[model samples]
Target: MNSDYRKPLPGASMQGEPVDFFDARQAVEDISPGAYAKLPYTSRVLAEQLVRRCEPKLLRDALTQLIERRRDLDFPWYPARVVCHDILGQTALVDLAGLRDAIAERGGDPARVNPVVPTQLIVDHSLAVEHNGDDANAFEKNREVEERRNDDRFHFINWTKLAFKNVDVIPPGNGIMHQINLEKMSPVVQCRRLDSGAKVAFPDTCVGTDSHTPMVDALGVISIGVGGLEAESVMLGRASMMRLPDIVGVELSGRLAPGVTGTDMVLAITEFLRRERVVGAYLEFFGEGADALGIGDRATISNMTPEYGASAAMFYIDDQTIEYLKLTGRDDEQVALVETYARHTGLWADDLDTAEYERVLRFDLSSVTRTLAGPSNPHAHLPTSELARRGIAVDYPRAQQDEQAGR
Candidate 1:
């Protein structure tokens, strides 16, 4: 055991002490360090497990599986649950409906092709924020427009609501999916009965079709946003396999200035991290700065993991994670169990040591400025000072030219 190994956390004992925790790289060896350099946060977690769990000789073979053929690997991904907002959920169901048609044409039973996993779809994304700032009828008017514009989509979704099994649909006019997940959907700790009827507690983990799925990571659940293609495979019970990634430890220091919203900080970090090119790497944020951020703020940052092109932006189980579980309406007993399990199992932030990483990055929060990202891509940041340079200000001459052209 390394002398640096921290003691096991309080309830994390189900897996044993800190010393017994798996070494990320001990299971796999001798790959070009450069290749690991660019793997994203989500890829990093997948790699770590593949290295630590698979047979030693097959480690390299397994690592190369995704890289060599781009074929889906056979691994176990027990997602806590599946989440979707209406647009993508509807589209995914449409694909399934179309697949059903294809399968039926091929002389297979379409009814047998239902999702094997529990799926939740919310109808929220289509609501345009056309009306703003607490208008009494804004929601109603928005709903009306939403219904008109999305008639075809809704017709299909309504059909799915009745036709699909192992699926639940949250009708329109609810809050955003991420917010709802934070407020209602995600269960910080999940319970399952074993074959012998003994209940077991494990860390909650899931994959959402939307990129913002990582928002739940702030609650210490290992949730990630995946593309529709990859999600389809997982939906059908396929393991997303790959080599271990370079775990990048990002140490955030300092505090945001007053009046700076979490949004501002995230936009700034997105710009900085993108410049550093931590693409396709698993990022673990730690230090005094992380402690300073509220769970909501952390969720905001984690939600944008895809925007930065990384896989999982993870914050380890810590006081923040515990507090979030409480704030989000998780049962007190379950929240306590999460704290207990994480501490005992060495999954807590403080217990991570031999947990090796290929690289580390430092960020100073005090330096972040009030900002927004837009016009084209989220990474194309336009600091307020550079707005004129980016042609954001209206040009009266050009407007006049366009007005005359219209006439």
Candidate 2:
């Protein structure tokens, strides 16, 4: 960690005192006056991590890329954690064991090999649903089938949990991995103690083994999906190399119509973003419409990020985020820490009023109607009203005739 940017974090600590934090906003401003205020939310968070973790020699250049919005040079990003499902998680652990064997053969201590980053492996994907949902005991029956079928796999997975350091295993039937990460796994902000006996707080960032990992982005955490190999590398303590991405600003305006569900709005937004060609871009959503959305509603949009071809769909840390943290059973002290850190570090939603974006897309929430996407592709957006015109819907008489004729 660079000492130059380190400063005291202003917040009531768990012991009722201030915590230490890296002052990224001040560091950015010192280099380029007034530039930090103009950075989008994503940039600000990236800058903070750069300040906290980048080598002192490379710090300036890395931050300059963010300040100038340049993607010319690759910078290092150290994710706070890694999330995985049983399939890839098992493969990664097997690779680690192989590496340990190789190390022992080379006269090195195999015991020293362990993941530097914390990893959580959830067995949510391997379960088979043997019983129908209508059955009252379907969940239990399905779990039993999963246990029987995946006995060997489960044994290996359970062994990994005990054999590996920094690995936490959530056994099968816990919940969907993404939803678990959103509501329980991610802390929104993380605080740690250094070797020198000082504490520092930073925003939570992670890379998951699944595409829908960006669901935590709704909580203002910078989470993204990675391939199995990349996830393995990160687990082994390698920084994920990245150049600054095309950060696009999406300004949501107006409120949703009464009775409109978040599903409809997300489907509409997904189609709109895909049409605008947001492939591989990091999108920051803000404005009156975004402020009005609850964390659940924001998560609805963020969960479809890959379908819309965006890398991350991020929101700012705001009151809704705070409320959601509370509703999800987070401790009051931790919730206060999140809000305090964000506000002090210029990551709060209100602090970003002056943030500027290179490309701004305006979307009206009220314009969204009941919608559906994809008979085949998720991007195939069709409002309910257009279904008949598009020949996807038939009149009652035609439907009856087709049903009778079995056509």
Candidate 3:
């Protein structure tokens, strides 16, 4: 461990003072302290902000409002840009089209309503690799299949692209949205020139229609994946309201075993965390174990935020973060700015002690074995040896004959 690395950060609180900013200690009183141990990663991040930003009266008000009145509260959410892959993007648009018709029937202009925030829709995720590995024509064949199946959806998307404001379309044949986000999008620290001619900086936060939006969390952006209905509400400038959540600090120890891809590690972690029931909490991955993983590996874990049912899987600012920013073509100045801001703001991994989570979970990398999850859910782990017991390995020659004879 670096001696100078793990110091308390300055100006770490939203109110600029340390006053038990989400009252993790107090909130745990109403519920069993042990219950806090099970919150998902997403809920934890939200809890952190509610503690830091919500006014005291509003804090109690906000907490009770939803549970008591069930009313939605408007809070500030500034997503850098809305990201969508083709499938969900198309479905979301279909809903919007329905909404337009509903508005027209109510004597409102259908064309007048639009996304209030900057939105980017990418045509990825519809491509399935029916063809095998890296053949010269594989990309072409895949594109053909994609275009054929998605023609109706594409036609609507084309209309949407021209009809809507604040929307940009990245056409098909591009890579996955998260990969593109890492490669080209996501300015680690966003800067906008204010009307007074001074530059202002705030944390980058976003909500994507897809559940994997947390992939960008590896870059220190506060992002969450929401359902289309929830996203539509957010798009219309509504605040997502809620009570404070339990933020769980996951202390990872030891490096991953060799030949283990980030995917494998994340799969293992996903199963373990799900069994632990950390749904809706914010999970911060830190320690020597976290420091050792490459940014790509961190992203793999973060990308599965939905699989583990956590809100955000965050890896704090560190040397690996800086390296990823550079590798992804971020400007040198912006990269330096990220380090400066994080170090100053206590957002850095080292600055996080007395960082105070409602709960904590620990994991050891060495104990994870080669495994696979699912006959259904990603969290359902079915060891290979159990296949026979699960009936997955049964002889099917007679079953095939019965099906052919319609018996």
The candidate, 2 or 3, that scores higher on lDDT is 2
Q: Please give the lDDT score at residue 314 for candidate 3.
A: 86
Who wins the TM-score comparison? Answer: 2
How high is the CA lDDT of each candidate model?
0.68, 0.91, 0.67
Model 2: how far residue 314 lies from native, Å: 0.3
Best by lDDT: 2
Tens digits of per-residue lDDT for model 1 on 1-407? 11112122334323232212333333223464434434433443455445434555565666664233233545434465678877667767878889999999999999887776667888888877777668988878888898999898888888887888878888888777888877777766555444543345445677787878888777766777777766666566555654344457888999998977787788889888899998887788878898788888888888889888887788767887787778777777767677766665456666653354557888999987767676568766666656556787656687789899995
Per-residue lDDT, model 1, residue 77, is 41
Model 2's alpha-carbon lDDT is: 0.91
Q: Which stretches of candidate 1 lie over 4 Å from their true place?
A: 1-80, 98-111, 129-135, 371-407
Model 3's lDDT to the true fold? 0.67
Ranking by TM-score: 2, 1, 3
The stretch of ten residues in a row with the least summed lDDT in candidate 3 is 1-10
Instruction: Report the C-alpha lDDT of model 3 over 1-407, residue by residue, as the tens digit.
Output: 01111222333322232211123324533534443333333333343344444554555444343223223564333354567777776676777778889999999999987887666788887888888766889889989998898898888888889988767788889888888776666776555443544344334567777788889888877778877767766666565664344467898899877766565577778888998898987788877888888888888889988888888888877888888889878877677667766565456667664355556788887655555675467666555556667788754687789899999
| C-alpha RMSD by candidate, in order | 8.8, 3.2, 10.1
Each candidate structure's TM-score, on Cα atoms with residue i matched to residue i, is: 0.72, 0.93, 0.70
Cα displacement (angstroms), candidate 1, residue 126, comes to: 2.2
